[model samples]
Target: MLFTSIKPMLVASGDEAFDDDDYLFEPKWDGGRILLHKQGERIEAYTRDGQLVTAKFPELKEVAKSIKAYAVILDCEGIVLRGGRPVFDDFAYRGRISLSAKIKQAVLTHPAVFVAFDILLAEKECWNEPLSERKKRLSAIVDTSSSLMATMSVEGKGTILASLMKERNMEGIVAKRKNSKYIQDTVSPDWLKIKHDKTIDVMILGYREEPFSLIIGLNFRTVKNKPVGLVSDGFSQADKDLILSLSKELHTVKEVKTQWIRPELCCRIDYRDRTDTHQLRMTVFRGLLRDKRSEECVWES
Candidate 1:
C-alpha cells in the first residue's frame, strides 16, 4: 500500500517565502529515484516505476539493516557521490543485468548512498504526516554514513545549494514547498526545479523509427575530427514533430545514416556528465536557438 509514482510538486517563491517554522527542505539529488519497500521484514527496493533494484546496490543494503519499521516504505533519492560530486558510473554498472565482478568492483569505487527525503510509513502509523514530520523520522534511520543522513537539508535557500550544484556541475535544484502535506494521490505546483542553461549543436545524420519514438543521430565533437559517441535522446515534442516533417526533406546519410539538417536551427540543451569527453549523460531539450550560426555551433575541442 505504498505510493509509487505520484505527480511531483513544486515550490514557488513568494514574499517572505519558505520563511515558516514548520517547513523543511533537502538538497535535491541528481540521481535515480528510489522507493524503498520494507513490508513485514520483506525488504526490497524499487525504482519509481516499481522496477526491482535492491541487490544492485549493496551499500543501500547496509542502510537497510538498520530499518526498525516493518511493513513500511520510504521515498528517497539514491545518489553516488565521490569527491563531492555525483558519480553516475555506479548506476550504469548496476543497470547491466548480468553484472560482472569488474563492474561490481567499480561500484565499490563509487559507493551509492541514499538520501531519504520522506517517509510514507511510520510504525503502523501513516507517515502521510506533513513534510516536516516525515523528514524527521527518515533522518533517524541508523547505520548509514551518507552525507544527508543527520538532518533536514539546509532550509529554504536554494541560492547557496544552487552554488554547490553549479560548482559540481550538478543537474539542478528541486524546491519543495514548506508545510506541503504528503499525499499519495495529488498533484500541485508545490515543487519547483531549476536547471543550468546549456546547449550545443549536433549533426542529425539519421533518424530511426519504431511503432512510435524517434531515434535521433548525434555526432560527437572530436579533437582530430572523428565522431566518437552517439546520442539519441534530448528531443522535445515540437522538435520531434518538426523532425518528422523534415525527414521528408533530408536524405539519410549512408555511412552514418544520421538525418542531416540544414545546421541552421540549433538547440539549447542542458545536460550533465562525468567525463571530459563532453558527452552528455543525461540531457533535456531547452529550445531551438535560431541565431547561433552553425560556424559558432562548434563545441570545446
Candidate 2:
C-alpha cells in the first residue's frame, strides 16, 4: 500500500494529571511527530504537517529493515538524545538542514531515535483496533533494539509519571485511554497531553491597537532580535493601557498600521514549547518584569 499522506491522531492539552487504571501514561517526547511507512525494503517518513522528511534523516531508512511486516505504517516521535535526555532542539535542527552532506554529518554528530508509540497500520489497517491491541501488534512487529524503538508506557500512574517528568525537567507525560481507537486527523480527548509550562522573559518589540496585542521577541546578542509571536491573552485593561502608553513614547514606525517599540520593556511569558521555526507556542503574557532589562532576556533553550 502506497500511503501518500495520512494525518495522525492528535492529543488534547490537559490542565492536570489523574490516576486511571483504564489509561496508559507515556513520556511526551519533545520532538517532531512523524509517520513512517514501510514496505519491504522501501521506507517513507512524513512530518505532522505532511512534509516528506525521509531524505532528511537517512539513518531512519534502516528502520524499514527492522519491521517484519511486508507493509506497515508506524506513528513515532523523532528525537535526538544528549546524555540520555531528549534534546528537541537537536532533532529540530536536523529537520532544517538542507544539504545532504550536512545532514549526513549531523546524523553522526546528533543521531535521531524514532520512538514508535502507535501502529496505525500493520500488514493491514489497525486504526480501528483498541489501543491495547494496537500496542501489542506494534510490539510484535518492530525490533526494540533498533534505532526505531517502542515508547515505554505505564498502565496507570499518570500523576506519578507527570511528577517524575517535571522533577527530571523532561517534556511532560501523555495519558491515553487503553480502549480508545485511533481517530485520524482528530484532536481527541482520549489522548491528553500534560506539558510542563515553561516561562521566559521576552522584550516587547511591538504592539497592535485594534484587537490589542503585543509583539514579543527573544533578546540575543550575536543575532538580530526577531519576533517570537504575539501575546494578547492573560492581560488586563490596565496592563494594556500601560503598554499602550509606553508604546506611544517608544514606538517607531515600522509597518503601515503596526508600531515597533524599543525593545526596552520585558515581560514573562508562559509557553509550552517553541515551534519548528523557533517561535513560541501556546504563549500567554504572564506579567511585566519591572526590574528586568531587555538585554537580560536571553534565549533559554
Candidate 3:
C-alpha cells in the first residue's frame, strides 16, 4: 500500500496528569511532529500539517536504514536535544531554514533525532490495531541505536512521570489509552497533553486597537520594563471593552497602531514556557490583578 498525505492524530489538552491502569504515559518531547513513511529503501518525512520536509532534514535519510520493515508509517517527533532535553527553539531553527548551504551547516551544528512514539503502519495496516499492540510491533522493527528510536512509555504512572518532567524542566507528559486506535487528523481525547502549568504577573504596557490585544511586560532589574509580547486570548468581551476604553485615559504614546499605556495596571499571565529568546510561549490573560503593583511584576533572575 502507498501512503500519500497523512495527518498525525492530534492530542487534546489535559488539565492534570493522573495515574490510570488503562493509560500509557510518555514525555511529550518538544519539537515538530513528523510522519515517516518508509517503503523499501526510500523514506519520506511529512510535517503534522502534511507538508513534505524530506529534503529539509538530510539526517532523516539515515532513518531508512533504521527500520527493519520494508514498508511502514511512523508517527514521530523530530527534535534537537541539548543536555538530553529536547529544545524546540533549536528544532524550529533546523526546520525553518530553506537554503542548502545553511541547512548543511545546521545539520552539523544542530543535528535532529526522530523519536518514534507510535506505529501507524508496519508490514501491513496497523492503524486499526490497539495502541499497545502497535507499540509492541514498533519496538520489534525500529533500530533504537540508529538516528531513529522508539519513544519510551511508562504504564500507570502519569503523575509520577509528569513530576519528573517538571523537575527536568522538560515539555510535559502525554497520556494515551492503551486500547485506543490511531484516529488521524482528529483531536482525540484518548491522547491528552498534561503540560506544566506556569503563571507570571506582568504589567500591561500598552494595547493594540484592532482585534484587541494587551502589550505586556515585566520589570527587570536591568531593563526596567521591556515589552515581552502581546496577548489576546482568555479575555471576555467585557474585559476587552474595559481595556480599550481605559487605554484612552491612560494613553502615553502612540506607535503605529499600538496605544502605549502608563504601565500602572498589572495582570497575571498563564504560559506554557519561555522560548530561547525569552518570549512567553502559549500565553493566556488570566485577568487583572488589582492588589499587585506594576513595579512588583519583576522578572526574577
Clashes of 2: 0
Q: Taking the tens digit of each residue's C-alpha lDDT, what string does model 3 give over 31-133?
A: 9899999999889988988788888888877888889999999999999888878878689888889999999998888899999999888878899899999
Candidate 3 vs. true structure, TM-score = 0.76
Error of 2 at 291 (Å): 5.7
In order of appearance, the predictions have TM-scores of: 0.60, 0.81, 0.76
RMSD of 2: 3.4
Q: List the residue pairs that clash in candidate 3.
A: none
> In model 2, which runs have C-alpha deviations exceeding 4 angstroms?
68-70, 82-84, 207-214, 220-223, 231-251, 254-259, 281-293
> Model 3, which residues run further than 4 Å from truth?
1-3, 199-204, 207-214, 217-251, 254-270, 273-301
CA-lDDT, candidates in order: 0.54, 0.86, 0.87
lDDT of 1 by residue, 1-301 (tens): 5534333222443221233233344555656667676755466677765677766766555565667665567776777675675655444445444465654684667566767777777665544566666666776653356523432466767666667666766665656655667654344456555555444554343455532222222333433222323444666667778766755765545343345434344455544432333455455555555565445555432
Weakest 10 consecutive residues, lDDT, candidate 2?
Answer: 217-226
The pairs that clash in candidate 2 are none
Clashes of 3: 0
